[model samples]
Target: MLEHLKKEQINPSIIEEIKKYRQKYADTADTSQTSLRYLYYGKEIWEAAVHALLCGENLLLAGSKATGKNVLAENLARAFRRPCYNLSFHINMDASSMIGNDTFRNGEVVFRPGPIYQSAVDGGFCILDEINMARNEALAVLHSVLDFRRTIHIPGYDQIPVHPATRFIATMNYGYAGTRELNEALASRFVILQMPSITQDNLTRLLLREFPGIKKQFAEQFSGLFSDIEKKCESGELTEKVLDLRGLLDALRLIQNGLSPYPALDMGLTNKTFDAYEQTLIRDIITTRISKKTESTTIFS
Candidate 1:
């Protein structure tokens, strides 16, 4: 997996650090089971993440939706050849949910470890997905673990020391609805990387990478369509729901599978917004891009 990243011309020192970590620890988890493959870390964010991780600094990827923060986190884990634990932070996740909780197992209370606890003990890379959604109070437990101290203090248990190789790559979107600002103290713990929106060329390459059978012309069209929707969202003409790369890809898949582009595009773009007026605006954008004869056409046929 790391060999494929050579084309990106990553820093030699970062490569050596990853190799050293691979040699130092036994990687217990296999990331090959997922459908998510062929990640392309263009230039900037890739170097920042690699350098930060090599420096033993925790990583915090801040960006809006569809900037590939989670994908980069997964790629880093695979590149470093380490087990990864994905812990999704929502409004309800508390400190105990992150560390561990005492549960009765056949009449005796036993500590059942959470993602953070296990990652701390076993030295795995834990991806804290949507870290901002977590209440700042709930995430305070992570302070010691992320800092130089590298320890997790459980209220009922002993202060567990983190393994040398343990790392947390957290991702959060600012200004998104239902998201909160991360406390300064927590934000200060990691090397924060502001991820940029992917370029059109990179977006096309990503589509081709994920769906090799997709025609280049259609890939360009899909990329353009996504960019258009994103612009509309940014302009407030449409809601953020339609600005989705995954949805566009899924709609392309549907088209390839014989659905009309209009319906397929609807499934992907227009249907995302619940407001009737917003859906009408979204539909107008789609119709403006895809014509009547074009609607019937699939990728190849």
Candidate 2:
């Protein structure tokens, strides 16, 4: 399945550009405090990401929101020691926004290159984050870049050959509204990896790893709450918008800050989903499972 990477090798110049971009963004990309201790589900997803990257193939990571799709993308780039350029897609995104555009400057139409073009030319790894959110026309710009024939043509500019080391990793939360089906041409060009829901054991490990002194029983309860939410989401009873474990972690942090568990949990996790009824249900779940008191005697402290 990963045959295309070895078959169509990128040029040496493109590889050099990738190295340069890596150096340029070294100060900005922070992966240091990522709790490198990720779950088993994350490991397999990351392994597939690494496999695609090493083989020099563009990757499409398709999954629901808060499923750690972007996290795995960043982790893969860090693991490969590659520089990453993230381009967030939206409904208004355009080809010119991605490739490049021509504008008058000093009475001349100067070509201002976009992130995708710049990243391709520089040989850096470009992550098309939330790709499905954009219209198909906007994503059509990437067809040539993903194919064995390496080129990105923007009108009013030269046909720029993609950098050899420049591979694209696109992520999409399929359950999100206004997202389009990835075009078949585009899909056929790159490898696709479906990310799985994080497991309870891994969530427990993550909680323990991040909040070192938290009690085992407490962590188990929290993990179980997350599992229940996952089941709710899978069954279409709840929206993916409220499924962020990171939000739950933030709520826990707020609890440690003297905020009542009710208020903290409400502010950090449940309220993020936006539906009134769902929010209420989510709050009730947290209140029942997590503590409602804000006393300083936390499970960890």
Candidate number of the best lDDT = 1
lDDT of 1 by residue, 160-237 (tens): 999888889999987667888989999999889998878788898888877777778878877777778788878888
The global C-alpha lDDT for each of the candidates, from Candidate 1 onward, is 0.82, 0.73
Clashing pairs in 2: none
| Winning candidate number (TM-score) | 1
What are the per-residue Cα lDDT tens digits for candidate 2 across 47-99? 56666766778899998766777777765565444456889999899988888
RMSD of each: 2.7, 7.4
Which residues of candidate 2, in runs, are more than 4 Å off? Answer: 1-41, 103-109, 235-241, 272-284, 291-296
Weakest ten-residue segment in model 1 by summed lDDT: 27-36
